[model samples]
Target: MGEVKDVPLLSELLKDSPKNWGKWGADDEVGSLNYLTSLEVIRGVGMVRSGKVFTLQVPMGAPEGDPIWPGRRTAQRVNVMDHSHYQCGKGPHFPGELHYADDMMIMYLQGSTQYDALGHVWYDDQIYNGFEAETTTGGMTKASVLPIAEKGVVGRGVLIDMARYRLKNVLDRGETFDHEDLMAAAAQQGVEIKKHDILIIRTGFIGSFYTMPSDNFYDNFVEPGLTYSPELVSWFKDMEIPNLVTDTIANEVTIDPVSGIALPLHSALMRNLGVAFTEITILDELADDCAADGQWAFLYVAAPLKVVGGSGAPVNPVVIK
Candidate 1:
């Protein structure tokens, strides 16, 4: 919520932004999520004037097709009882009907709409708050996704709506925007990025994909996202925003310009800053609703699956205006 002033670029801030290793504590697991205090939740609740809810999750099997991520299988669902078995009264005991539809699913938790827990990424053999990498290989003993799932993420959610404001719903693949762009868009929308807010950026990626669904296109092609810049990281740290969700696979540009690291922003946020991220979120409906009503900030409610010791989990986040 501070004024936008000139500051060192990401490259410089990357060297200076102190690691939040022990800011919360050496044993801290939830990372920046600690920012979501009860008062913050109360602030979010007060924003819900219309009581309209918008779910921000893309379906588990999205685009009406095969899996988009390579090597990850599509979500599988199977009935526990077949038609023949159910008809023969082989199902569990019941008075009138002896049949029931019981089903199970085998899914890749991070395949669709998901949250990248603090344990999901690391750098220099360290995770958030200096947890070792070896411990995370088997399963994260520290900073596991369970804690986040158990303690729901609730706060004021703000949508940047970059696609509609800047690209006119035609964002190009591999295009990247930086901190200035984010601030400019927010200013244009008359929305301020508040502390401890769940910041959601709409790049129009998910919206575009729905129109032309292609596994190959999504899996291999470049995509538009926030540029992996130190300036952007600095802004996040300065703003104290806890969670970030975007309509892109990777929150940052696919290729880093300076270090050439594949996902430098992930390392900066998850590894260095303890900030959580959600990717491939469905934000078109939220964007449209915000544009129609001019209410950009609202109450955000998201609960990650309580997958014990898991790196990440699928999430269904809802925004209420």
Candidate 2:
């Protein structure tokens, strides 16, 4: 691929951003994910020279202090054996001869490190590919997260360690950065953004979660994330990035800098361009490994649960260098 040169600003791209509604096709459901072609997977495979792997998913049930989002439940595990008829030394088996344990969990699919499906966000009653925003109660016929889960996300992953480049423990809450900032971080790390790549940005926020009070971290702390700007969205579109992963709750700044719009990044990327997001990922270890080896590109892989009609699903993403 060639270097990205002189890309237009968000202001210039907004007019055409909406025009992308039918660019893939009227019946297209996989939006920007179309960029993750077989060629891209080949390129990703070529990046795995080190053979070291890093898991990007935070541990399940790790965020147990309080609910981050209202109505979103923390994961809970229960021993199902209690309810089972089979018991040790009972009717099903002889004493100490056979023992079995069963367990079950209830959780919000998007509660942890997860990908937001194309139907996860929308603008003014429309979803990706101009699908009308209507579905039967808790189910969806189109734009559900299942397509992504089925296809699986595989590509070259590039890490832009903003926290390390900026020399901050963590980017302060409410801090916003633009395209230039991202480019600078990539340049500083001797990496290049390529077409169809899964971009991972490290704010070092997830590391802070362990050191700070849960209440302070969730309630009082504003998060540092990408700026919700037309320029940033334009850059992603121009680069043909299929998916984004960030070590922050909201990929964009917590509070929208733009007036009247809440999550412009989500709207532009997910709703309009079909770009997916894996938010609240743990990237500190990956960033550290990249920095140590001086290699920022790796093979990224993620498989979401095949939840029918789900808007989003928790993901266990891995980066192999």
Among all candidates shown, the one with the greatest lDDT: 1
Worst 10 residues of 1 by lDDT: 1-10
CA shift of 300, model 1, Å: 0.4
lDDT of 2 by residue, 196-274 (tens): 8898899988778777777677775467888666677778889888898899876877656554344567877887888
Global Cα RMSD, each model: 5.6, 6.4
Q: Indicate the worst ten consecutive residues by lDDT in candidate 2.
A: 1-10
Q: For model 2, what is the alpha-carbon lDDT of residue 213? A: 75
List candidate 1 stretches off by more than 4 Å: 1-17, 66-68, 82-84
Please give the distance, in angstroms, between residue 14's alpha carbon in candidate 1 and its true position after superposition: 4.7
Q: Alpha-carbon error at 177 in model 2, in Å?
A: 0.7
Which digits, one per residue and each the tens of the lDDT, describe model 1 over residues 185-279? Answer: 99999999887889899988876767774754565567777767657788889888789889887777776644445667887887788888888
CA lDDT, every model vs. true structure? 0.79, 0.78
